[model samples]
Target: MKLGKSVNFTTILLLMFNMLLTSCGKNDDGSGPSPIPEPGDGVVYLPVVVHVVHNGEGLGEGPNLSEQQILRQIEILNEDYRRKLGTRGFNDHPDGGDAQIEFVLAKKTPDGEQTNGINRIDASQENVPDLGYNQNHYAQYAYWNPEAYINIWTTPLPESSMCLALGNATGPKTDLPGTEHLSIPGPNDADGIMINWIHFGESNIDCHARFGRTLTHEMGHFLGLLHTWGSGDCETNDYCDDTPPVDEHVYGNVPFVGCAGEEVMIGNYMNYSHDEVMNIFTNDQIQRMHYVLKHHPGRNALLTSPAL
Candidate 1:
């Protein structure tokens, strides 16, 4: 089930080339795929279990990410959540914020066995499609208790070319106050993220989204945040006052003025901006996430899970 060294990279190149044709079109924004959240202890610590679904390539190569790669990716997640001052996640924007949440690699399995926090799946041997449109193909392998951990499955997907499914989450039915009626579609049933393997960790993948920000972006969705322009155009709001209502999802790091005539938060992770330019999560967004993490039954469970 192992892929040759060139196959994965070459495929990634093909995907990037496809982006050029699709760039003119707006991203089909809004996320579902419900990866819930956690709370309490002043600084919430949620355990994470990353499942690397590969074609059976060696560790750290292809999709079988090595321990070091996985570790670094988790670090990126933390840096963004904590808004660490010296890292890419840091920002001085008046609206910027730290979610005050941290992702702890699961030190134990659902069955209570010690683990290094990564699960490797050989797609070929496991009877799972390596590349496909249906995300449920890997659901059968999801952790027994998904809400207890941030279950992230990383692998390439055919839908990547559509500028749609590079990274997705199982998001909760957000109950953040003032927007109690506003729901996050329906990844409501399951929890966790399914991201394109190439963008899950640090890599020289020859693309604008190689810095692992896709996961951070999707994680925002997982914790119940919405796109800055939920339905694109001036049609809807993301429920975060700090984020202006933009016309559509922003792609590159270009300047943009929203429907309200305010400069858009292009650096905000919730938008579809490129990885190199994305950073802030904003004060309003942080509050929404904290509310969801504090009240959602499933999300609260993660905070108490023995896995942490």
Candidate 2:
């Protein structure tokens, strides 16, 4: 996408120079400068176990996503997070960087039993309630240790909604001072992500958001990245220096110049853009996620947890 017509040539030249310096760091071996970890240094593997909550729905029906569909979502997460080379959304933007994170299906349950990493539950609560589905109620069907596995509950939204949200996730609670204890694996109801079945895969549900980007966006929140527009306006910051601050969320692929005269990063995963348009994650965002993996009590455990 065109960033903007107002970019200064001198600034671009300076950026290029900085990149050259970064790529030419001194090395004792004299073989050459070490490759800078623009994306990151080491890969962080996260184990995921998806809980398919279906209300007596058979395979390939309703919220009961088939195993293949679930695997497809996992593949998308790995591709997007790693920014795999030649991927459809891959770009050469200087600020954009691979997150160096991969999601794998767990091979064992928390109780040291063999499993396929998928838990199927036929619960009535899988059906959306009149007041919208309750995450805690849905989680009752199947919930593993949140510290070791990313729990994803897929279900349908209430039928009476004015608008449909593909998914929602609970942001990391580590920021709360008194709530630090609650960050660890426990019986907390608000610990995992709840996704609309249609948006979980490349299905023919919501065309605008059917390409599995909803989970990618929600995962950003689970890892502590805020909306690119912060809470509301351009005045508030999402805490990432590379993500340009916008007056508000940019939906679809619309070009929007922020108050600071910089073009808004509509393609950022954290934005409300459509699946096809949302792709890049700024370097600052990668750094923030790494910090969460290293420091957050609830999330740090996943870094070393064995997928098996």
Best by TM-score: 1
Off by over 4 Å in 2: 1-40, 125-132, 158-163, 175-188
Report the lDDT tens digits of candidate 2 across residue range 1-308.
Answer: 24357878887787789867866765766567654232246887788888887777788777777999999888888878988877645767899988888888898898888888888888764453343465576666777888889888887545333127677777665553222312233454547887877788776653688788889988888887887877556665687778888867678877689868999888899888988887799999898888777778778887666653
User: What tens digits encode model 1's per-residue C-alpha lDDT throughout 1-308?
Assistant: 34566677778777778766665445455243323333433688888888888876787776777888888889999898898999988888888877789999888898899988888877767654533433365565555476678888886454344244577776776445334323343453445678887677777766788888988988887788888877554745777777877867677888687796788878989877887788898888888888888877777788877888
Count clashing residue pairs in model 2.
0
- Poorly placed runs, candidate 1 (over 4 Å): 1-41, 128-135, 156-165, 176-189, 233-236
